[model samples]
Target chain A: MVSLYFLLFYINILLIGCVLVYIYKLRKLIGFQLGMTISMVAGGFFAFTSGIIFIYVYPFHFLPVTIAATLLGMAVGSIFGSFFDYQTLLSGYSNGLMMGMMSPMVGAVAKNSFLFLSFAECLFFASLLLVLSSARQT
Target chain B: MILYLYTMLGINILIPAVLFLTMKKKRKLFTDRYGMTISFSASLIFSLSLGTALFFTLPVSFSVLIFISAAAGSIIGLSYGILITFQSLIIGLFNGTIGSLMGTMLAAVIIDPSLCGLPSQFSTLLDRNIILITLFLTLLSLLSSLLLRFSYRV
Candidate 1:
Protein backbone atom coordinates (compact mmCIF):
# COMPACT_ATOMS: atom_id res chain seq x y z
CA MET A 1 0.00 0.00 0.00
CA VAL A 2 2.80 2.39 0.84
CA SER A 3 4.58 1.56 -2.37
CA LEU A 4 1.38 2.09 -4.28
CA TYR A 5 1.03 5.50 -2.71
CA PHE A 6 4.57 6.36 -3.68
CA LEU A 7 3.91 5.23 -7.22
CA LEU A 8 0.86 7.45 -7.49
CA PHE A 9 2.79 10.34 -6.02
CA TYR A 10 5.55 10.07 -8.62
CA ILE A 11 3.04 9.74 -11.45
CA ASN A 12 1.34 12.90 -10.33
CA ILE A 13 4.60 14.79 -10.37
CA LEU A 14 5.36 13.49 -13.82
CA LEU A 15 1.96 14.60 -15.03
CA ILE A 16 2.45 18.08 -13.66
CA GLY A 17 5.80 18.32 -15.41
CA CYS A 18 4.19 17.30 -18.66
CA VAL A 19 1.48 19.92 -18.27
CA LEU A 20 4.06 22.59 -17.62
CA VAL A 21 5.81 21.67 -20.82
CA TYR A 22 2.56 21.70 -22.72
CA ILE A 23 1.72 25.15 -21.32
CA TYR A 24 5.13 26.50 -22.17
CA LYS A 25 4.75 25.31 -25.75
CA LEU A 26 1.43 27.06 -26.16
CA ARG A 27 2.02 30.03 -23.91
CA LYS A 28 1.88 32.43 -26.82
CA LEU A 29 -1.55 31.22 -27.88
CA ILE A 30 -3.17 31.48 -24.44
CA GLY A 31 -4.94 34.71 -23.50
CA PHE A 32 -4.16 36.51 -20.28
CA GLN A 33 -7.52 35.56 -18.77
CA LEU A 34 -7.18 31.89 -19.64
CA GLY A 35 -3.56 31.94 -18.61
CA MET A 36 -4.44 33.34 -15.21
CA THR A 37 -7.15 30.76 -14.66
CA ILE A 38 -4.94 27.93 -15.82
CA SER A 39 -2.08 28.90 -13.56
CA MET A 40 -4.34 29.34 -10.56
CA VAL A 41 -6.04 25.99 -10.96
CA ALA A 42 -2.94 24.07 -11.90
CA GLY A 43 -0.78 25.45 -9.14
CA GLY A 44 -3.50 25.06 -6.54
CA PHE A 45 -4.42 21.45 -7.26
CA PHE A 46 -0.81 20.39 -7.55
CA ALA A 47 0.08 21.88 -4.19
CA PHE A 48 -3.04 20.54 -2.57
CA THR A 49 -2.57 16.95 -3.68
CA SER A 50 1.10 17.01 -2.86
CA GLY A 51 0.37 18.40 0.59
CA ILE A 52 -2.13 15.67 1.30
CA ILE A 53 0.23 12.98 0.10
CA PHE A 54 3.09 14.33 2.21
CA ILE A 55 0.92 14.46 5.29
CA TYR A 56 -0.32 10.94 4.73
CA VAL A 57 3.19 9.59 4.29
CA TYR A 58 4.66 11.30 7.31
CA PRO A 59 1.84 11.78 9.76
CA PHE A 60 4.28 12.59 12.52
CA HIS A 61 6.06 15.52 10.88
CA PHE A 62 3.23 18.00 10.55
CA LEU A 63 5.48 21.03 10.87
CA PRO A 64 7.86 20.17 8.06
CA VAL A 65 5.09 18.86 5.86
CA THR A 66 3.11 22.07 6.20
CA ILE A 67 6.10 24.25 5.50
CA ALA A 68 7.28 22.15 2.58
CA ALA A 69 3.85 21.94 1.02
CA THR A 70 3.34 25.70 1.29
CA LEU A 71 6.66 26.43 -0.33
CA LEU A 72 6.07 23.86 -3.05
CA GLY A 73 2.75 25.46 -3.85
CA MET A 74 4.29 28.91 -4.06
CA ALA A 75 7.06 27.70 -6.33
CA VAL A 76 4.68 25.83 -8.63
CA GLY A 77 2.31 28.80 -8.82
CA SER A 78 5.04 31.27 -9.57
CA ILE A 79 6.54 29.02 -12.21
CA PHE A 80 3.22 28.48 -13.98
CA GLY A 81 2.18 32.13 -13.67
CA SER A 82 5.49 33.39 -14.98
CA PHE A 83 4.52 32.10 -18.39
CA PHE A 84 2.06 34.96 -18.81
CA ASP A 85 1.55 38.34 -17.16
CA TYR A 86 2.42 39.57 -13.69
CA GLN A 87 -1.27 39.56 -12.86
CA THR A 88 -1.50 35.89 -13.69
CA LEU A 89 1.47 35.27 -11.45
CA LEU A 90 -0.23 37.08 -8.59
CA SER A 91 -3.46 35.15 -8.93
CA GLY A 92 -1.74 31.81 -9.22
CA TYR A 93 0.55 32.48 -6.29
CA SER A 94 -2.31 33.40 -3.96
CA ASN A 95 -4.45 30.45 -5.00
CA GLY A 96 -1.64 27.97 -4.49
CA LEU A 97 -0.88 29.36 -1.06
CA MET A 98 -4.48 28.99 0.02
CA MET A 99 -4.84 25.43 -1.23
CA GLY A 100 -1.47 24.31 0.09
CA MET A 101 -2.29 25.58 3.55
CA MET A 102 -5.63 23.82 3.55
CA SER A 103 -4.59 20.46 2.12
CA PRO A 104 -2.93 18.98 5.17
CA MET A 105 -5.94 19.56 7.38
CA VAL A 106 -8.19 17.99 4.82
CA GLY A 107 -5.88 15.03 4.53
CA ALA A 108 -5.56 14.59 8.28
CA VAL A 109 -9.31 14.68 8.77
CA ALA A 110 -9.99 11.93 6.28
CA LYS A 111 -10.67 8.49 7.81
CA ASN A 112 -9.17 6.63 4.91
CA SER A 113 -6.19 8.49 3.52
CA PHE A 114 -5.77 6.11 0.59
CA LEU A 115 -9.30 6.47 -0.65
CA PHE A 116 -9.27 10.22 -0.13
CA LEU A 117 -5.99 10.57 -1.96
CA SER A 118 -7.34 8.62 -4.90
CA PHE A 119 -10.43 10.79 -5.07
CA ALA A 120 -8.40 13.96 -4.83
CA GLU A 121 -6.08 12.73 -7.54
CA CYS A 122 -9.02 12.04 -9.79
CA LEU A 123 -10.31 15.55 -9.26
CA PHE A 124 -6.94 16.99 -9.98
CA PHE A 125 -6.72 15.04 -13.20
CA ALA A 126 -10.18 16.11 -14.23
CA SER A 127 -9.36 19.74 -13.61
CA LEU A 128 -6.16 19.45 -15.62
CA LEU A 129 -8.03 17.85 -18.48
CA LEU A 130 -10.54 20.66 -18.43
CA VAL A 131 -7.72 23.18 -18.53
CA LEU A 132 -6.07 21.42 -21.43
CA SER A 133 -9.27 21.20 -23.45
CA SER A 134 -10.04 24.83 -22.85
CA ALA A 135 -6.56 25.79 -23.84
CA ARG A 136 -6.96 23.87 -27.04
CA GLN A 137 -10.30 25.50 -27.73
CA THR A 138 -8.70 28.89 -27.59
CA MET B 1 4.84 38.88 22.57
CA ILE B 2 1.46 40.52 22.20
CA LEU B 3 3.13 43.74 21.19
CA TYR B 4 5.08 41.97 18.47
CA LEU B 5 1.93 40.38 17.10
CA TYR B 6 0.19 43.75 17.15
CA THR B 7 3.08 45.28 15.23
CA MET B 8 2.79 42.57 12.62
CA LEU B 9 -0.90 43.21 12.30
CA GLY B 10 -0.23 46.92 11.91
CA ILE B 11 2.20 46.25 9.12
CA ASN B 12 -0.30 44.03 7.35
CA ILE B 13 -3.03 46.68 7.62
CA LEU B 14 -0.67 49.49 6.63
CA ILE B 15 0.28 47.72 3.40
CA PRO B 16 -3.23 47.62 1.96
CA ALA B 17 -4.00 51.15 3.18
CA VAL B 18 -0.98 52.56 1.40
CA LEU B 19 -1.72 50.58 -1.73
CA PHE B 20 -5.31 51.78 -1.80
CA LEU B 21 -4.25 55.39 -1.56
CA THR B 22 -1.70 55.02 -4.31
CA MET B 23 -4.15 53.23 -6.56
CA LYS B 24 -6.82 55.81 -5.88
CA LYS B 25 -4.46 58.59 -6.80
CA LYS B 26 -3.76 56.96 -10.12
CA ARG B 27 -7.15 55.43 -10.75
CA LYS B 28 -7.55 57.18 -14.02
CA LEU B 29 -4.22 55.95 -15.29
CA PHE B 30 -4.99 52.29 -14.69
CA THR B 31 -5.90 50.15 -17.65
CA ASP B 32 -8.65 47.57 -17.45
CA ARG B 33 -6.32 44.60 -17.07
CA TYR B 34 -4.14 46.34 -14.52
CA GLY B 35 -7.13 47.36 -12.46
CA MET B 36 -8.47 43.82 -12.37
CA THR B 37 -5.08 42.39 -11.47
CA ILE B 38 -4.50 44.89 -8.72
CA SER B 39 -7.97 44.40 -7.39
CA PHE B 40 -7.49 40.64 -7.26
CA SER B 41 -3.97 40.53 -5.82
CA ALA B 42 -4.24 43.35 -3.32
CA SER B 43 -7.45 42.11 -1.74
CA LEU B 44 -6.16 38.55 -1.65
CA ILE B 45 -2.83 39.25 0.10
CA PHE B 46 -4.43 41.83 2.34
CA SER B 47 -7.02 39.40 3.65
CA LEU B 48 -4.59 36.50 3.85
CA SER B 49 -2.05 38.40 5.93
CA LEU B 50 -4.76 39.91 8.08
CA GLY B 51 -6.40 36.55 8.79
CA THR B 52 -3.14 34.84 9.72
CA ALA B 53 -1.98 37.68 11.95
CA LEU B 54 -5.29 37.93 13.73
CA PHE B 55 -5.43 34.20 14.35
CA PHE B 56 -1.89 34.12 15.73
CA THR B 57 -2.44 37.06 18.03
CA LEU B 58 -5.71 35.85 19.47
CA PRO B 59 -5.92 32.09 19.24
CA VAL B 60 -8.90 32.18 21.55
CA SER B 61 -12.11 31.26 19.81
CA PHE B 62 -12.26 29.42 16.51
CA SER B 63 -15.71 30.63 15.51
CA VAL B 64 -14.84 34.24 16.24
CA LEU B 65 -11.61 34.01 14.28
CA ILE B 66 -13.39 32.65 11.21
CA PHE B 67 -16.03 35.38 11.35
CA ILE B 68 -13.55 38.18 11.85
CA SER B 69 -11.25 36.98 9.12
CA ALA B 70 -14.04 36.49 6.62
CA ALA B 71 -15.50 39.90 7.38
CA ALA B 72 -12.14 41.57 7.01
CA GLY B 73 -11.59 39.74 3.74
CA SER B 74 -14.91 40.89 2.30
CA ILE B 75 -14.27 44.48 3.30
CA ILE B 76 -10.87 44.49 1.68
CA GLY B 77 -12.32 42.94 -1.44
CA LEU B 78 -15.10 45.53 -1.67
CA SER B 79 -12.77 48.42 -1.14
CA TYR B 80 -10.30 47.31 -3.79
CA GLY B 81 -12.75 45.81 -6.26
CA ILE B 82 -15.19 48.71 -6.14
CA LEU B 83 -12.48 50.94 -7.53
CA ILE B 84 -12.55 49.10 -10.85
CA THR B 85 -15.79 47.45 -11.97
CA PHE B 86 -18.48 45.01 -10.92
CA GLN B 87 -16.54 42.15 -12.40
CA SER B 88 -13.44 43.09 -10.48
CA LEU B 89 -15.55 43.44 -7.38
CA ILE B 90 -16.77 39.86 -7.71
CA ILE B 91 -13.32 38.56 -8.38
CA GLY B 92 -11.77 40.45 -5.49
CA LEU B 93 -14.51 39.50 -3.08
CA PHE B 94 -14.41 35.79 -3.90
CA ASN B 95 -10.64 35.50 -3.74
CA GLY B 96 -10.36 37.59 -0.58
CA THR B 97 -12.92 35.56 1.30
CA ILE B 98 -11.37 32.29 0.18
CA GLY B 99 -7.88 33.41 1.15
CA SER B 100 -9.00 34.40 4.63
CA LEU B 101 -10.93 31.17 5.09
CA MET B 102 -7.88 29.14 4.21
CA GLY B 103 -5.65 31.26 6.41
CA THR B 104 -7.95 30.83 9.40
CA MET B 105 -8.16 27.09 8.93
CA LEU B 106 -4.40 26.73 8.56
CA ALA B 107 -3.75 28.73 11.69
CA ALA B 108 -6.37 26.78 13.59
CA VAL B 109 -4.82 23.44 12.75
CA ILE B 110 -1.37 24.69 13.60
CA ILE B 111 -2.52 26.04 16.97
CA ASP B 112 -4.22 22.80 17.88
CA PRO B 113 -2.72 19.75 16.31
CA SER B 114 -5.57 17.46 17.25
CA LEU B 115 -7.87 19.52 15.09
CA CYS B 116 -6.04 18.01 12.09
CA GLY B 117 -5.71 14.51 13.59
CA LEU B 118 -2.08 14.99 14.50
CA PRO B 119 -0.70 13.98 17.89
CA SER B 120 -1.03 16.83 20.38
CA GLN B 121 2.22 16.37 22.25
CA PHE B 122 4.48 19.06 20.80
CA SER B 123 3.05 22.08 22.54
CA THR B 124 6.39 23.81 22.90
CA LEU B 125 7.43 23.11 19.35
CA LEU B 126 4.04 24.25 18.07
CA ASP B 127 4.46 27.62 19.79
CA ARG B 128 7.77 28.22 18.10
CA ASN B 129 6.44 27.01 14.76
CA ILE B 130 3.59 29.49 14.97
CA ILE B 131 6.00 32.37 15.34
CA LEU B 132 8.07 31.16 12.42
CA ILE B 133 5.06 30.66 10.17
CA THR B 134 3.69 34.09 11.08
CA LEU B 135 6.98 35.73 10.23
CA PHE B 136 7.16 33.80 6.98
CA LEU B 137 3.65 34.85 6.02
CA THR B 138 4.42 38.50 6.80
CA LEU B 139 7.49 38.36 4.60
CA LEU B 140 5.52 36.69 1.81
CA SER B 141 2.98 39.48 1.85
CA LEU B 142 5.70 42.11 1.95
CA LEU B 143 7.37 40.57 -1.08
CA SER B 144 4.11 40.35 -3.02
CA SER B 145 3.23 43.97 -2.25
CA LEU B 146 6.64 45.06 -3.41
CA LEU B 147 6.05 43.14 -6.60
CA LEU B 148 2.64 44.76 -6.99
CA ARG B 149 4.17 48.21 -6.67
CA PHE B 150 7.00 47.32 -9.02
CA SER B 151 4.51 46.28 -11.68
CA TYR B 152 3.55 49.93 -12.09
CA ARG B 153 7.09 50.92 -13.01
CA VAL B 154 7.33 48.21 -15.65
Candidate 2:
Protein backbone atom coordinates (compact mmCIF):
# COMPACT_ATOMS: atom_id res chain seq x y z
CA MET A 1 0.00 0.00 0.00
CA VAL A 2 2.75 2.42 0.88
CA SER A 3 4.65 1.46 -2.19
CA LEU A 4 1.58 2.08 -4.28
CA TYR A 5 1.16 5.51 -2.75
CA PHE A 6 4.76 6.39 -3.48
CA LEU A 7 4.56 5.11 -7.01
CA LEU A 8 1.52 7.23 -7.66
CA PHE A 9 3.23 10.26 -6.19
CA TYR A 10 6.29 9.75 -8.32
CA ILE A 11 4.21 9.45 -11.45
CA ASN A 12 2.32 12.59 -10.63
CA ILE A 13 5.48 14.58 -10.14
CA LEU A 14 6.89 13.34 -13.44
CA LEU A 15 3.75 14.24 -15.30
CA ILE A 16 3.74 17.70 -13.80
CA GLY A 17 7.32 18.24 -14.78
CA CYS A 18 6.65 17.25 -18.35
CA VAL A 19 3.65 19.51 -18.58
CA LEU A 20 5.52 22.51 -17.25
CA VAL A 21 8.31 21.95 -19.75
CA TYR A 22 5.89 21.81 -22.60
CA ILE A 23 4.38 25.08 -21.54
CA TYR A 24 7.78 26.70 -21.18
CA LYS A 25 8.76 25.64 -24.67
CA LEU A 26 5.54 26.91 -26.13
CA ARG A 27 6.06 30.27 -24.48
CA LYS A 28 9.58 30.53 -25.83
CA LEU A 29 8.46 29.80 -29.38
CA ILE A 30 5.74 32.41 -29.18
CA GLY A 31 8.03 35.31 -28.23
CA PHE A 32 9.61 36.98 -25.22
CA GLN A 33 7.73 36.30 -22.04
CA LEU A 34 8.33 38.36 -18.94
CA GLY A 35 9.39 35.92 -16.25
CA MET A 36 11.72 35.47 -13.34
CA THR A 37 13.97 32.62 -14.36
CA ILE A 38 17.20 34.50 -13.68
CA SER A 39 16.08 35.75 -10.29
CA MET A 40 14.85 32.31 -9.34
CA VAL A 41 18.20 30.81 -10.27
CA ALA A 42 20.04 33.47 -8.30
CA GLY A 43 17.80 32.90 -5.32
CA GLY A 44 18.56 29.18 -5.31
CA PHE A 45 22.25 29.97 -5.20
CA PHE A 46 21.72 32.43 -2.39
CA ALA A 47 19.83 29.82 -0.39
CA PHE A 48 22.68 27.37 -0.88
CA THR A 49 25.21 29.87 0.43
CA SER A 50 23.04 30.69 3.41
CA GLY A 51 22.66 27.00 4.19
CA ILE A 52 26.45 26.65 4.29
CA ILE A 53 26.77 29.64 6.54
CA PHE A 54 24.15 28.28 8.86
CA ILE A 55 26.09 25.05 9.15
CA TYR A 56 29.71 26.26 9.31
CA VAL A 57 29.27 29.81 10.57
CA TYR A 58 26.55 31.74 12.31
CA PRO A 59 23.03 31.32 11.09
CA PHE A 60 22.82 34.11 8.49
CA HIS A 61 19.06 33.85 8.99
CA PHE A 62 17.83 35.17 5.69
CA LEU A 63 16.22 33.65 2.64
CA PRO A 64 16.98 35.39 -0.65
CA VAL A 65 15.31 32.62 -2.60
CA THR A 66 11.99 33.16 -0.88
CA ILE A 67 12.26 36.84 -1.54
CA ALA A 68 12.99 36.20 -5.17
CA ALA A 69 10.01 33.93 -5.30
CA THR A 70 7.81 36.58 -3.76
CA LEU A 71 9.03 39.15 -6.22
CA LEU A 72 8.95 36.83 -9.19
CA GLY A 73 5.82 34.80 -8.42
CA MET A 74 4.71 31.88 -6.28
CA ALA A 75 5.29 29.20 -8.89
CA VAL A 76 8.94 29.98 -9.16
CA GLY A 77 9.33 30.63 -5.46
CA SER A 78 7.52 27.42 -4.46
CA ILE A 79 9.56 25.36 -6.85
CA PHE A 80 12.79 26.60 -5.34
CA GLY A 81 11.28 26.55 -1.89
CA SER A 82 10.20 22.94 -2.29
CA PHE A 83 13.71 21.91 -3.25
CA PHE A 84 15.08 23.50 -0.12
CA ASP A 85 12.21 22.14 1.92
CA TYR A 86 12.69 18.59 0.73
CA GLN A 87 16.42 18.60 1.29
CA THR A 88 15.96 19.83 4.83
CA LEU A 89 13.22 17.32 5.48
CA LEU A 90 15.37 14.50 4.21
CA SER A 91 18.22 15.60 6.44
CA GLY A 92 15.89 15.75 9.48
CA TYR A 93 16.06 19.44 10.07
CA SER A 94 13.09 21.73 10.75
CA ASN A 95 9.73 21.77 9.06
CA GLY A 96 8.93 23.71 5.88
CA LEU A 97 6.93 26.28 7.82
CA MET A 98 9.92 27.18 9.93
CA MET A 99 12.10 27.57 6.86
CA GLY A 100 9.56 29.91 5.31
CA MET A 101 9.68 32.09 8.36
CA MET A 102 13.44 32.23 8.12
CA SER A 103 13.42 33.30 4.49
CA PRO A 104 12.93 37.05 5.01
CA MET A 105 15.32 37.10 7.90
CA VAL A 106 18.05 35.41 5.86
CA GLY A 107 17.42 37.82 3.01
CA ALA A 108 17.86 40.79 5.30
CA VAL A 109 21.29 39.73 6.48
CA ALA A 110 22.70 38.48 3.18
CA LYS A 111 23.55 42.10 2.21
CA ASN A 112 20.85 41.78 -0.39
CA SER A 113 17.46 42.01 1.17
CA PHE A 114 14.74 40.95 -1.22
CA LEU A 115 13.05 44.31 -1.79
CA PHE A 116 16.11 46.28 -2.88
CA LEU A 117 18.48 43.62 -4.17
CA SER A 118 16.17 41.89 -6.62
CA PHE A 119 15.13 45.20 -8.14
CA ALA A 120 18.74 46.26 -8.45
CA GLU A 121 19.76 43.00 -10.08
CA CYS A 122 16.86 43.17 -12.48
CA LEU A 123 17.53 46.78 -13.39
CA PHE A 124 21.20 46.20 -13.87
CA PHE A 125 20.54 43.39 -16.31
CA ALA A 126 17.85 45.36 -18.10
CA SER A 127 20.15 48.35 -18.56
CA LEU A 128 22.94 46.12 -19.74
CA LEU A 129 20.61 44.59 -22.31
CA LEU A 130 19.44 48.02 -23.36
CA VAL A 131 22.99 49.23 -23.85
CA LEU A 132 23.92 46.19 -25.93
CA SER A 133 20.81 46.56 -28.06
CA SER A 134 21.53 50.26 -28.65
CA ALA A 135 25.09 49.46 -29.57
CA ARG A 136 23.79 46.94 -32.08
CA GLN A 137 21.39 49.56 -33.47
CA THR A 138 24.31 51.95 -34.03
CA MET B 1 8.03 -8.96 6.73
CA ILE B 2 6.77 -7.96 3.32
CA LEU B 3 4.71 -5.22 4.89
CA TYR B 4 7.78 -3.59 6.38
CA LEU B 5 9.56 -3.67 3.09
CA TYR B 6 6.60 -2.09 1.39
CA THR B 7 6.42 0.65 4.02
CA MET B 8 10.05 1.43 3.52
CA LEU B 9 9.60 1.52 -0.22
CA GLY B 10 6.67 3.88 0.19
CA ILE B 11 8.74 6.36 2.18
CA ASN B 12 11.41 6.24 -0.45
CA ILE B 13 8.99 6.89 -3.25
CA LEU B 14 6.99 9.63 -1.54
CA ILE B 15 9.95 11.81 -0.65
CA PRO B 16 11.38 11.80 -4.14
CA ALA B 17 8.01 12.18 -5.73
CA VAL B 18 7.27 15.26 -3.68
CA LEU B 19 10.68 16.65 -4.48
CA PHE B 20 10.25 16.06 -8.18
CA LEU B 21 6.80 17.60 -8.34
CA THR B 22 7.80 20.61 -6.31
CA MET B 23 10.92 21.17 -8.41
CA LYS B 24 9.42 20.62 -11.86
CA LYS B 25 7.59 23.93 -12.19
CA LYS B 26 10.73 26.00 -11.97
CA ARG B 27 13.65 23.89 -13.06
CA LYS B 28 15.37 26.91 -14.61
CA LEU B 29 15.66 28.43 -11.15
CA PHE B 30 18.39 25.98 -10.18
CA THR B 31 20.68 26.85 -13.10
CA ASP B 32 22.95 29.02 -11.01
CA ARG B 33 26.34 27.35 -10.57
CA TYR B 34 26.71 28.52 -6.99
CA GLY B 35 23.56 26.74 -5.78
CA MET B 36 24.50 23.44 -7.42
CA THR B 37 28.01 23.44 -5.98
CA ILE B 38 26.88 24.29 -2.48
CA SER B 39 24.08 21.74 -2.47
CA PHE B 40 26.36 18.98 -3.67
CA SER B 41 28.96 19.85 -1.06
CA ALA B 42 26.34 19.89 1.66
CA SER B 43 24.92 16.53 0.62
CA LEU B 44 28.40 15.00 0.71
CA ILE B 45 29.04 16.39 4.16
CA PHE B 46 25.68 15.18 5.41
CA SER B 47 26.24 11.69 4.04
CA LEU B 48 29.65 11.52 5.71
CA SER B 49 28.36 12.61 9.09
CA LEU B 50 25.55 10.07 8.99
CA GLY B 51 28.03 7.40 7.98
CA THR B 52 30.21 8.18 10.97
CA ALA B 53 27.27 8.03 13.32
CA LEU B 54 26.22 4.68 11.94
CA PHE B 55 29.61 2.95 11.95
CA PHE B 56 30.95 3.98 15.36
CA THR B 57 29.33 2.50 18.50
CA LEU B 58 31.45 2.69 21.61
CA PRO B 59 29.64 3.70 24.80
CA VAL B 60 32.01 6.41 26.02
CA SER B 61 32.75 7.73 22.55
CA PHE B 62 29.21 7.40 21.18
CA SER B 63 27.63 10.53 22.65
CA VAL B 64 30.42 12.87 21.59
CA LEU B 65 30.63 11.33 18.18
CA ILE B 66 26.88 11.53 17.62
CA PHE B 67 26.79 15.16 18.65
CA ILE B 68 29.45 16.02 16.14
CA SER B 69 27.63 14.03 13.52
CA ALA B 70 24.40 15.90 14.25
CA ALA B 71 26.09 19.26 13.97
CA ALA B 72 27.80 18.39 10.72
CA GLY B 73 24.64 16.87 9.34
CA SER B 74 22.68 20.00 10.20
CA ILE B 75 25.18 22.23 8.49
CA ILE B 76 25.28 20.23 5.30
CA GLY B 77 21.55 19.78 5.26
CA LEU B 78 20.96 23.50 5.68
CA SER B 79 23.51 24.40 3.06
CA TYR B 80 21.96 22.06 0.54
CA GLY B 81 18.52 23.51 1.23
CA ILE B 82 19.60 27.15 0.92
CA LEU B 83 21.96 27.08 -2.02
CA ILE B 84 20.51 24.40 -4.28
CA THR B 85 16.91 25.22 -3.59
CA PHE B 86 17.39 28.89 -4.47
CA GLN B 87 17.55 30.66 -1.12
CA SER B 88 14.73 28.90 0.60
CA LEU B 89 15.70 29.27 4.19
CA ILE B 90 12.60 27.38 5.21
CA ILE B 91 13.88 24.46 3.22
CA GLY B 92 17.35 24.79 4.74
CA LEU B 93 16.11 24.66 8.30
CA PHE B 94 13.65 21.94 7.47
CA ASN B 95 16.35 19.80 5.91
CA GLY B 96 18.63 20.19 8.90
CA THR B 97 15.96 19.49 11.48
CA ILE B 98 14.30 16.68 9.63
CA GLY B 99 17.55 14.89 8.92
CA SER B 100 18.50 14.88 12.56
CA LEU B 101 15.06 14.00 13.81
CA MET B 102 14.66 11.16 11.38
CA GLY B 103 17.99 9.66 12.30
CA THR B 104 17.19 9.79 15.97
CA MET B 105 13.67 8.55 15.42
CA LEU B 106 14.82 5.59 13.41
CA ALA B 107 17.21 4.63 16.17
CA ALA B 108 14.49 4.94 18.77
CA VAL B 109 11.53 3.37 17.01
CA ILE B 110 13.16 0.72 14.89
CA ILE B 111 16.36 0.04 16.80
CA ASP B 112 15.48 0.47 20.44
CA PRO B 113 11.86 -0.40 20.72
CA SER B 114 12.44 -1.51 24.29
CA LEU B 115 13.96 1.31 26.28
CA CYS B 116 15.10 -0.70 29.30
CA GLY B 117 16.61 -3.67 27.58
CA LEU B 118 19.50 -3.72 25.09
CA PRO B 119 19.72 -6.52 22.59
CA SER B 120 21.96 -7.26 19.63
CA GLN B 121 18.90 -8.16 17.62
CA PHE B 122 17.88 -4.50 17.73
CA SER B 123 20.98 -3.57 15.77
CA THR B 124 19.94 -5.77 12.91
CA LEU B 125 16.52 -4.20 12.74
CA LEU B 126 18.05 -0.74 12.84
CA ASP B 127 20.40 -1.63 10.07
CA ARG B 128 17.59 -2.88 7.93
CA ASN B 129 15.56 0.23 8.48
CA ILE B 130 18.50 2.44 7.62
CA ILE B 131 19.10 0.57 4.41
CA LEU B 132 15.49 0.82 3.40
CA ILE B 133 15.27 4.56 4.06
CA THR B 134 18.52 5.24 2.27
CA LEU B 135 17.48 3.29 -0.77
CA PHE B 136 14.17 5.14 -0.96
CA LEU B 137 15.78 8.55 -0.60
CA THR B 138 18.28 7.75 -3.34
CA LEU B 139 15.56 6.85 -5.77
CA LEU B 140 13.75 10.05 -4.90
CA SER B 141 16.90 12.04 -5.52
CA LEU B 142 17.35 10.48 -8.92
CA LEU B 143 13.76 11.18 -9.88
CA SER B 144 14.16 14.75 -8.68
CA SER B 145 17.06 15.27 -11.09
CA LEU B 146 15.03 13.96 -13.98
CA LEU B 147 12.11 16.22 -13.06
CA LEU B 148 14.45 19.15 -12.94
CA ARG B 149 15.57 18.45 -16.47
CA PHE B 150 12.03 18.10 -17.69
CA SER B 151 10.96 21.34 -16.05
CA TYR B 152 13.87 23.22 -17.56
CA ARG B 153 12.38 23.32 -21.03
CA VAL B 154 9.52 25.45 -19.80
For model 1, the local distance difference test gives: 0.84
lDDT per residue, candidate 2, B1-154, as tens digits?
4454454435443443454355544445665543443344234323332432342222345466456556755654554555445554444454554554444433343334333122224344555554544454344345434533344343
Candidate 2 structure quality by residue, lDDT tens digits, A1-138: 335434533443453354345434443332111223322332333333333223222222122333332222323334433333333222211122223323333333443234543443354345334423432342
The i-RMS of every model, in angstroms, reads 1.7, 16.3
**Model 2 misplacement above 4 A:** A1-138, B1-60, B81-94, B116-130, B145-151
Per-residue C-alpha lDDT of model 1 across residues A1-138, encoded as one tens digit per residue = 767777878998899999999989999999998998999899999989998888888887777787788888888888999999888888788778777877888888884457788899999999999988998898
Q: Work out the TM-score per prediction.
A: 0.91, 0.31
User: Which regions in candidate 1 have their CA more than 4 angstroms from the true location?
Assistant: B59-61
* Native-referenced TM-scores of chain A, all candidate models: 0.96, 0.24
